[model samples]
Target: MSAAALLSPSAPLPYSGAITDVAGIEVGHHTDPRRPTGSTVVIARDGAVAGVDVRGAAPGTRETDLLAPGNFVQQVHAILLAGGSAWGLAAADGVVRWLEERGVGLDVRFGRLPIVPGAVLFDLPMGDARIRPDAASGYAACDAASTAAPAEGNVGAGAGALVGKLFGVPHAMKGGIGTASVKVGGVTVGALIACNPLGDVVHPDTGELLAGARTDDGTALRDTRRSLLRGDVPRPLLAGTNTTIGVIATDAVLTKVQAQRLATVAHDGLARAINPVHTMSDGDTLFTLATGRVPLGEEAPGMTVLSVMAAEVAAQAVVRAVLAARAVTTAELAIPAARDWPGRRAAA
Candidate 1:
């Protein structure tokens, strides 16, 4: 069975196994195959306390500074994940405008300015470089936003995403959008990710590579970590051609510092699933949002449990991304689907 099919409704959901499983959170995607790129918006419309942790050496982001604990803005209207690298940050403008028109945002003396923090992944080389996500795309994504289960694999920011590029583009595999959630003590925590990285995606439990570099014949998997340990030098391909950006959310109330801590621990999920993560070439970032719906218990262990759950869901979401991805071919690149990979097929 394909990865998308395997995670069907019949599949077990510890929680809803989706980001939308969290109440008051809506997600939407705007995909343009012609541009072969797109954008995704996560609406915290009622406003949610948010924090970010950027681990990638190279990143493209907008308005993240405002999300800091010391910043004046205490909440954000939405979060955007898009393709087109730095150029894609423009998509946030549409999201800001969407909130503004709806009368949502921080109230100032004259008007309200919605706080929209966003990040971008490198997908320009996968398609026509000139064609990228724009303000219109962001607006459309918001318009299509829904509380229903999000469409995964080859959608939104991951539409043009390719993974395991430590070797080169030709050896990389298709990556996409994925989501998973877990419920604990009536509090639901969920994660949504766009997987486009420079290293291999691995199954956390078994340590099996789910997606990454392939053999020259494209018939087998290559251990990206193994190659690096062997001192096999990699050719300098397109640097900064990768990033994995995601958001983890919960209904549990948390302080800004705790939210930031959640984002920090969540990187453990990225490290568990991807070999050579947070490299200079990748912009691996994670954001945490708390809706303040559920009261966190008055104990340090409660935060620890939330952090552990966050990492678990993040890793699971990354695996789902590759599993759901379909192959993509462009003039400059051809990325194989994870389902077709020999290792993945055998494991399935």
Candidate 2:
């Protein structure tokens, strides 16, 4: 059985240009078979702004000046979130190289290093098990970005991503890259995510889940109700082998502390959309960049409001990634069907 059966989207929905609302926030991706996993970055002009928030013990995040609030908050030059897990952390090195070549960064006491903020998820270990993200792969991941697509599913760090692993991979659904954005108080909030979680997702409005859990034959949805009420395995048979990563981008002004707070609030969005999120095993992390143009500062309630919107966008992106994923019949994991699936054409 797989998560393919238990969850679904309300209906197929396109991005509708929501992710691109942020000014100068350009996204790039690089995917290679040798690497399989890839990376995504939101690039801005030199000396823009940034900040971050760290929630997991095993996190591989980098260049977090973007999330901190202050005069420095608005100067995020770029952000990188990638899939090699901890090994993938090197992907940011390439971004550093790129920005260095282009002369984009801050010139504080640190002697003007390229300011590329980032976050990473634990996917390589699960996707290939034996494989870990390497410097060569990181270089390859970066070299291919010039022609990269926001290509959804089975690509980048999401290349081998799977979700709802309660019964293990057999019962999991394919999940990959997804992106979304929204406007609040004239500020554009965009979320780009790599969905690799170990729990089922709910619609939020109705208690009925849209996706997750398939039968043994891989044709029908399993009853999560029974799985819960029956307690087939005592203590909820959970393994902390999952994570969700993203950056919340806005043109509003914020400090690194406020940006970090923004990231904290943004986690609420992940929690609202993803069930059983930020768990012991999942190294869930979110980064927030002030972009430093607008004059928005840290206010808990205001941050909370933005966090709610971010959560909504993040959840939608996760669902979309699953929808865009194509079921693979590989020996490691095989999904029989898709839920709330989208953008796939049947093989001719």
Candidate 3:
């Protein structure tokens, strides 16, 4: 997916430009300058929330099983996002400790729900080698959660993101946090993603590819599919190499089960946006949250259309992620001649 000319943009929002869902859904991030790593979370009203889904082969997920249908937590005190790869699971401990200090989680007979659902992506090995995320960092991330709007593009867990590194970290694009929202039928369906896909991201409507793996032809820029078609690719195993994890935040009221179902449907949004997605090399996952704030009138025409519109928002987000990405320090993916990427800054 080579960057194309500033082709035409995708279709505009089908509804009036106003996000009616996810009221007071706050976000926060803690960046440890010691390394190019961090964490993020979408805070619900008072952190009392629900629902999640795990759809990645090599996912380092948390609280997913607890989010099951039969048994669940009424309110989720907090959500944690962090770096550290699978080992970063330690970060959850920080969240637990933080929440416990504040007295949150399930009030089960044996104990509480401890329902601090979370997700992670691959940024290690390719990120700042000297600086690694740890428990303290995780606590800081969760402690910082508030009405502060989250930062996008190369921050948080995505601070160290590098794309198109099929063969290695070199010849990869700079991918990080990206977000796009749509308001339909007086309801808002917004998407936030930390893009680190193995495949190339493309412009859905214009059909002009945005960003992909590159060759080390002095420019260090090459087309992902074309190179693979030519039989010039990387090794077979690439863990934590490709994944774009995210969650669709909505104020639409849906049961925990219903929210999980929406998460499954939301993956379709990813499929329509990214090329060669959901590969074994990719740990692609999506989590949906129905805050039950927007008194959505059942599957009213407004909310139903919101679902479809969410798909479009997700696709556009992938495009934005590619453009927001910067050049990688990885020697292999570096392009001596290439300046800034094309079709960039064509944003709203």
Candidate 4:
């Protein structure tokens, strides 16, 4: 579908331009001041049917297995996305604690045990590796949760995100978080992505490079696909150092199995906007959450429609990520944002 068709609101209904447009969902972020790394949390206070799909080979996640269709757990209280690689997983503990304090989670014999699933991306290369998101960071994010549109770019899990590293860090651009939502009849679907892919971000409809590896002179986009086609091999990046993780949510009612299917098909959006997604060196993952507010039967046609909308919103969210990103420079390295790139300025 064309970008306009994918992004344009359906007739008679308008979108809130954020994932929080979905009822019963809230978003929050905690950016560490020590360096460019932080955490983002998506909370479903009353709990929502959830499913996850981990496409990258080197994924680092928590409680994902419990989200399986056959698993006894049917819902999740929150989903956490953070930067710090594996160590960032510790942040989920704080989310669990915050939810438990609020009496949210599956009731057991002793007390409520919140179910918080999460994924992480590597940003240690940007600055101080020692300073990463921890339990406190997660709690702070939850404390800041709000229904209003959360700030995008250079915050939350997207802080310190670097893209177009196929040629190495020096040739990369800054990446960040972005959110978008769309409405279809009574159903509304939204996506929030923290884009840090190993490949380039491109316009889904036009296929123009938005951000990626820069030329040797660092003055223009290198066009990763063309460079590879011309036999320009990429430098070896560390396994699990790159990823694009996000959450897709809707107010439509859906079964656990259907939610999983939605998560699977949503990867199409990633493929549309990201070149060479789900690579061995990347840990791409996506989660689906259904608020069960709108009644849409678990029939083939209803699922088909929701699936299409899911992918469209996901792709749009990816594009917004790079566009909203701002430049970030450390003492050791400087990464430009797509909006500030010389090629983009020259084109404008």
Candidate 5:
């Protein structure tokens, strides 16, 4: 079916405004009740060609090397995104075991070994640092997988997410998970992001700041970009303590190399929406998965179109993440949501 046909007046499949709109994809989340931290899983039970790109300097990842074009593993059974800094990488272990039990993964000589590559963002500072997502968390998220639109904001890996932390956590705003999808030609490109950047989130088209570091009074936003441009020095943040991680999936036929390119170009979306992204303190990473449901005639031209759509959806997802977030208050500090910002509400 052509993209036009899918968007016709009588088209059957309606856009969900979530990554689950992509065919052959299932999303699940597990938000810890004990604390504001958790894990998320994206499953491709039938397997999908996958690729990855890590742009941030202090990434905490697992099995990303295998996604290289020259590597032997060309597909991934699932992708995991979790909170808890380096410890969150362990969440992938549970996903691998779950997939193995279901007979999903690369068929090895003795048994099936599920190929689950994952990344983690730092959320340890938000709540109880010691109570991070464990293996059980990954299993629960996988168990919750479904084709339905997943919940957004303050859930899963984004539960503890805080953005615009250039001044410090106390000045940051609540961040969360968001998803978006767009159809191009005959394929659908979707993105799911756990936004926890060290910088501010801006409207991609309007160049308006939606959320970010707040003024000393915590009543107004202190635009991070302009603050830096004014020679304002920010407090030193711990490396690997902040990051934004996400996945981009599409229902288009693409080679492993093409998938990697898509992931690379998709970073443009992050740049467009995030101020001072991919910084030393931010372990930003993105992955791409191709389900091969729709085939394009020419690889070059198709990739160009797909890449553009991928960036658009990624930027949209980032903006939605903060917009959907809710205010979080604790004894130590209080973080406001974008919607609660008086300036933003007034503009709206």
Candidate 6:
């Protein structure tokens, strides 16, 4: 069979979409303005088959090993994406408690254990480092869950996120949340991302710089990738300064291996939009959740189709995130909004 046929037994991939397009999947966010850090929760109340891929050199993740194809668990109750770097992992505890209260999770002889896998990106520098996401933040996110389209840009894990830090904070731009989906045959694949890469964001199709480090005047875009190619290196970013975390959801039935493949391809989307992605400063990670609502009948599109669509959707979501991001200014810092770019609004 040809590659496309192996990927999916269907026609081609179609329009941008949302993760909620997958039935039974819900999303929620809780932003903590104190530290400007918060949590985002994706819940599969009925539980969903899940897999994960962590590519960045400095990832901060929880419970990912169990997601391997050979692990015992086959389904996950929820996935947590949050700010506050390693400290944000505490948010998963709240998610677990919420699931337990609702009687969701895998059955242990003693009590039901909610299977929650999570990842975090650094945002401490943007807000109060002393104040970070906690268990309460996770619980609050769960209470706020809804099937409606999730709020994007500077919410949840995206709050306090920054990009284009290669040239330092004065040149970096605000990064935030973005979502997109597409239809491949009868299957629907969607992606949601919290963008905060260490490099610049680029347009995949045109190779145009979308967002990233700005010129000294902070009125124009700077090409970090080109600078790197020319050996124009900047000082090292601080530890835990970047990451981009996201989730991929689909209505198609897939095995753990297939789900893993889907996540692996999703990173291609990130790479397309973010220059120098998966860097030592970034903890880039993606997770895939299959609701198993659609069966693989004859001529049914399979993993390959989902993978292709996922990569595109992911790339699109990255652009959407930077596009939707608002400027962040304090007495100490002033990150320009995408719209604030010279002639950016006019072009848009």
Q: Model 3 over residues 1-348: C-alpha lDDT tens digits?
A: 333432223322222221113565666667767655677666563553455656557777777776676774555655665566665556677767766667666566765444567777777765455455566767777777765445666677667665666655555567776667776555667777777777766567765555656555424345566667788757566665567877677766677777667677777777776766787777787777666666666444453475676667677666666555555554323421112654232221
Q: What is the model-wide C-alpha lDDT for candidate 1?
A: 0.86
1 versus 6: better lDDT goes to: 1
Candidate 3 local accuracy as lDDT?
0.62
Worst 10 residues of 6 by lDDT: 1-10
Candidate 2 lDDT by residue in tens digits, 130-201: 555544545455444442225566666666666666555676667677777777776667777777776555
The models' CA-based lDDT, in order, is: 0.86, 0.61, 0.62, 0.88, 0.88, 0.84
Residue pairs in candidate 1 whose N, alpha carbon or C atoms collide under 3 angstroms? none
Q: What CA root-mean-square deviation does each model show from the true structure? A: 3.1, 5.9, 5.2, 4.2, 5.5, 6.7
Off by over 4 Å in 4: 1-16, 297-301, 345-348
Tens digit per residue, CA lDDT, model 4, 36-61: 99999999999999999999988989
Which candidate model has the greater TM-score, 2 or 3? 3
Would you estimate the TM-scores of all the predictions? Answer: 0.93, 0.79, 0.82, 0.93, 0.93, 0.92
> What are the per-residue Cα lDDT tens digits for candidate 1 across 217-317?
67667788888787977869655679999999999888888888999999999999999899999989899899888887753238889999999999999
Worst 10 residues of 5 by lDDT: 2-11
Cand. 6 TM to true fold: 0.92
Task: For residue 1, give model 5's deviation from the true position in Å.
Answer: 30
* Candidate 6 residue 174 C-alpha distance from true site, Å: 0.6
Clash totals for all models, in order?
A: 0, 42, 10, 0, 0, 4
Positional deviation of 244 in candidate 5, in angstroms?
0.8
Can you tell me which runs of candidate 2 are displaced by over 4 Å?
A: 1-13, 56-58, 63-75, 108-111, 125-132, 135-149, 223-229, 234-240, 295-304, 336-348
